[model samples]
Target: MKLLTCLKQIPDRDTRYEINAAGTGIKTSDLTFEISECDEYSLEESLKLREEHGGEVAILTLGPQRAEKSIRKGLAMGADRAILVRDDEGKVTTPHAVAKVLAEVLKEEEYDLILTGTQSDDWSYAQTGVLLAELLGLPHATIVMEIRADPAQKKVKALREMESGWFQWVELPMPAVLTIQAGISQIRYASLKGIMQAKKKEIRNVELSDLNVDLSSIPEIEVLKVYFPVVEKKAEILQGSTAEVVEQLVEKLKKEAKVL
Candidate 1:
């Protein structure tokens, strides 16, 4: 089985962000980037599959040169190699564009399975994997919490999550895509030796233009502005007997907050 996992580098959740002067995106100069949290789980699951099935695991990431750090992390975690779709212009910003690029790239590669996080931390767009499946004309399942593969049968049984703690088992043929949910497994840390070895792994960089991608087909999803959630503070005191304070709280919930 040849497995491919799509990973993304995103700004660390704790990093302080400032809107750029253009206001179209955040300031990138001093921002810290790391693998999207959920992608780590995807990468780990792909590595585990390779360990059991005896195959090569490769990663695909789309970003600028800075994204190589995250790619190396995947290599240290046991991916055989990586393919980077270099996008210095940041043109591949939307999930639509990402899926288009990945589909085009994967068209030339042969893989038994493709895995990706259910959503990206930065964009929270939970559509890439499914969209890629559509573009590639492959069967797919999303929100996959568990995966069981049968090499002889050339298929995988996926446990998919549903609303209100429900799950369904789906058997998909080989050459499929799955969007993995978080908490699928405990992600392994990179050992010093593995980190050193990762330096020797191959990372192939491909410019977006080299793919012969149709410029007319790429859709544009513009971001008009980027800003953090506004933080507001307010305090109220109900100075009265316990019963009266309770009444005030109820009133506040029903009227002021309207959350009742």
Candidate 2:
């Protein structure tokens, strides 16, 4: 089985984000990028499948040239190879445009299964993988928590995560898409030897313009603007007994904020 895992490089989860001078997006110069935390689950699961079932795992990502670092991390973790789709000059890449190029790449490689993260840390759009599934005309399910493969039947049984601790078992054929959820399982780390081996693996580069993508079809579905959350804090010391302070607090809530 050939498993294709889609990964993304996003700003570190704990990185401080400051709006750009244009107020359109966050400042990028001081940011350190890494693989989206949720995406790690997809990569780890794919690697495990390869180790257990004996197949290949490929990591595919689209971002600026620096994103190659994120791809190399996946390679060290156990992916057979990587694909890098790059755009420089700090221009934001759209998901639909990425799916277009991915469709072209998929045409040449026959994959048994495709896995992706449930959502990205940066955009949280949760649309790209599903969009890719649509473009490929393949059955897909998002928020998958567990995966079980049956090689003989060429089928996959996955446990999907939903609201309120709910889970549903789903069956998918060989060629299908799965967007994996965070906390599906623990992620493995890259060792020193694997890190050295990653340098020797192949990483193919591709351009958006070379994919026969029609510019007219791509349009902005949403606009992004970064803003700081409004925050205010006030503290008052209680000067009376516990019951008296509780009474005073209720009065303050009713009269000041009217939220009681």
Candidate 3:
């Protein structure tokens, strides 16, 4: 009944971002980070499963040193411990590289289930979980909304959501991966007791080289540029009496905005 969850640290949603001078990435110096919102849902689901099945939940995260904050937050949310796959250089890698690293690390770990967010807010690639599953030769389901586990039987029923509110229920064998959707359950705040207990939780750091992964290796895809989206401006002011203003507005819409 042991469960593992993958957490990713992303920029805060409310943070005002600015494109870097090279147009290759955001100016991260002033940015605050938090666990991806969807990852929080996956963590909550993992905690809930552990609560019901009476086992441990361990978190796995890959990022720069600052990502330890997000890992600590997961521990405060009741994950028994955590493993941090560190990238000291803070070089942005592809989802494939990340999946490879996770697969390698997970090979030595013992777990009956693995969960990850449907997608990361920063990249929205939504490729890591399934890729990791493929690399590990494990079956997986994405957009998972619910799970019912039977540790004794070594099987779990997963409810997956499709387009237009449709859902598919699947029973997968033990050691399956699932990409969880957000809002599956309410995220709980860290209790004072849980916070204090988390201070003593183990956070084991594993460097990329220790996993036999090198940052200089080439990836399949290269990001040519990363810049802010172009901002379009549209505004109109109507003058004169109410009726005249209305007429002018309608005329302007028909002639200029083209939404008569």
Candidate 4:
């Protein structure tokens, strides 16, 4: 019944972002960070599963040193412990590289289930969880809205959300990975006592080198430039009698707008 949830730290949704001078990334100097919204749901799901099945819940995160704040918050929310893969150099940009690092850490551990957000807030790649599952050779389901675990039978049934308000049930054996969708469960707040106890919880930090992953070997999507989208506006008034105006509008739709 042991569960591992992957967490990520991202910029607050309300924060205004600016492209960096090199046009390669955003200027993060003044951005406020927090645990990603969907990841929070996954963490809450892990806590709920632990509560029902009587086992421990652990968090795994890969980010800069500042990410420890989010890990501590997860602990405060009821995670027993955490493993933080320090990436101060920011080398793990691609989803493949991230999955490789996480897979390396998971090699030494055993868990009945793994959870991750459907996608990250900043990049929205929506590929990390599936990639991690492939790397670990585990069965996985994405966009999961509900989970029913049978620890004794070593099987899990998940309800997956699909397009147009459709859902499908998927069953997988134990040691499976699931990409949790938001709104699957209500996230719990950290109580005062839990906050105090979180300070004493273990946060095992490891450098990227410790995992022996080579970032250069992984394929990456290059960002040639980052800029604000251009917006254009135009307006014209149709003047004439009702019949004339209708004709004019039709002509405009056929010629100027070309939408007819």
Candidate 5:
């Protein structure tokens, strides 16, 4: 049971962010980075699987060289190895482009399962995992909360959550990707010894230029601008008795916002 988990590094969610003067992106100097929360859940799930089934867990991340910090954290948590697709200057790469790069690397590996977070924290697009599966021509399921593997039968059983308050049972073949849901399991802390050992573990850094992939030829989606969201605060104070306050609130919802 070999597993490939996609990890991403994003700004620390707790930090307040500001857009740059050009409004094309956030101010890099003020940004503090960390492993995305959902991706960490994916890594934890993969580590738990490997710990149970006695196989390898690999971290696949595409970002600048700094992204290795997140991968090393994964290694310390129990991943066997890490692969870095370094993009200097932290340039944006389209989901399709990422799928292409992953396809290039994954074509040579024989893995029983692949996993990814439900979505990236910063982008929250939630398209990469399913898109990669589509590009690789493998069947995949999103919002997976549980998985049961049967190596003897060479099949996997998964429970998927639907938005309509329903669950779906799916049986998928080996080498399928799954976008994992949060709250499925708890993430374990890496022991100090594991952290020390992770420093010695091999992390192969692969460049897009070296992969026979032509960026010039790959037509990626263009982002004209990225900006911080403007936030505004408003308060509606109902000054009256209890029932009158409730009535005012209802009127505000029906008339002012029209979203009851």
Candidate 6:
């Protein structure tokens, strides 16, 4: 029951964001970072599974040096160790590139299950997990609400979330991938003792070169620009009797707003 959970570091939602000078990305100089919301749930789920099944939980992430904070947080939350693929230049910006790098690191390792967030908080692309599964040639389920592993049978049963508040059960062989939905489990905070213990845990840091992954060869979705959305507000007062006002509102809906 070796569980590996992929975590991402993202800008804190409460931080103020500003578009960079090139208008191609956010200015991250002053931004605070944290573990992505759903990834925290994935980490918690991995920890729970390890606690129940008597195995080790590991964390894997690809990010800049600052991402070590998120990795340490996962270790403090009960992950046995971590692997950090340092991407200081941000070359691995696309989902395909990320999946490729992760798959490269995972090629030599074996795990009973791999977990990832349904989507990253910053990009919300929601493609990395599935792409990683494809790259690794493993069965995968997305938006998983629950997981039950039968290690003796080398299989896992997962409760998948569907549209309209529906759910479906899926069974897959061991060594599968699962994209965990947020709120699937309660995320536990790092206790003082856990934090101290995490200080002694191992964090193996590697670079893209170490994995022999060339990100430039990967196809990327181009982003032409990134800017704050324009917001405009206007108010018009309808004058006259109730019927006239209602008629004016209807006319505005059809002509001005065009939502009718």
Worst 10 residues of 5 by lDDT: 227-236
Clashes of 2: 0
- Candidate 5 lDDT over 1-260, as tens digits, reads 89899999998888777877877667768677888887898899888787778789989999998888888999999899998988886653777777788878788677888999888888687888998898789999898888887766878888898888898989998778989988768889999999999999989998877775555666677767876557664765688999999999999999998998
Candidate no. 4 TM-score: 0.88
Name the lDDT value of residue 86 in candidate 5: 80
- Per-residue lDDT tens digits for candidate 1, residues 33-146, read 999987899999998998898999999999999999999999998999999999988878888889999888898888999999999888797989999999999999999999
Candidate 1 vs candidate 2: which has greater lDDT? 1
Give the runs in model 4 whose Cα sits over 4 Å from its true position: 232-260
Model 2: per-residue lDDT, tens digit, 135-223?
A: 99999888999999886798999898878978999998878999999998999999999999999999999775566667467765555
Where does candidate 2 have its weakest 10-residue lDDT segment?
Answer: 85-94
User: Candidate 5: RMSD over Cα atoms?
Assistant: 4.4
Model 6 lDDT per residue over 114-199, tens place: 99999988989999999999999999999999999999999999999999999999999989999999989889999999999999
**TM-score, each model?**
0.88, 0.87, 0.88, 0.88, 0.86, 0.88
**Candidate 4 C-alpha lDDT tens digits along 1-260:** 89999999998878779999899878998898999988999999999999899899999999999999999999999899999999998978878889999999999888999999999898889999999999999999999999999999999999999999999999999899999998998889999999999999999998888787777878778768878888564668789999999999999999999999
Local distance difference test values of all predictions, in order: 0.91, 0.85, 0.91, 0.93, 0.84, 0.93
Give the count of colliding residue pairs in each prediction.
0, 0, 0, 0, 0, 0
| Stretch of 10 with least lDDT, candidate 3 | 211-220
lDDT of 6 at 258: 100
The regions of model 3 sitting more than 4 angstroms off are: 214-219, 231-260
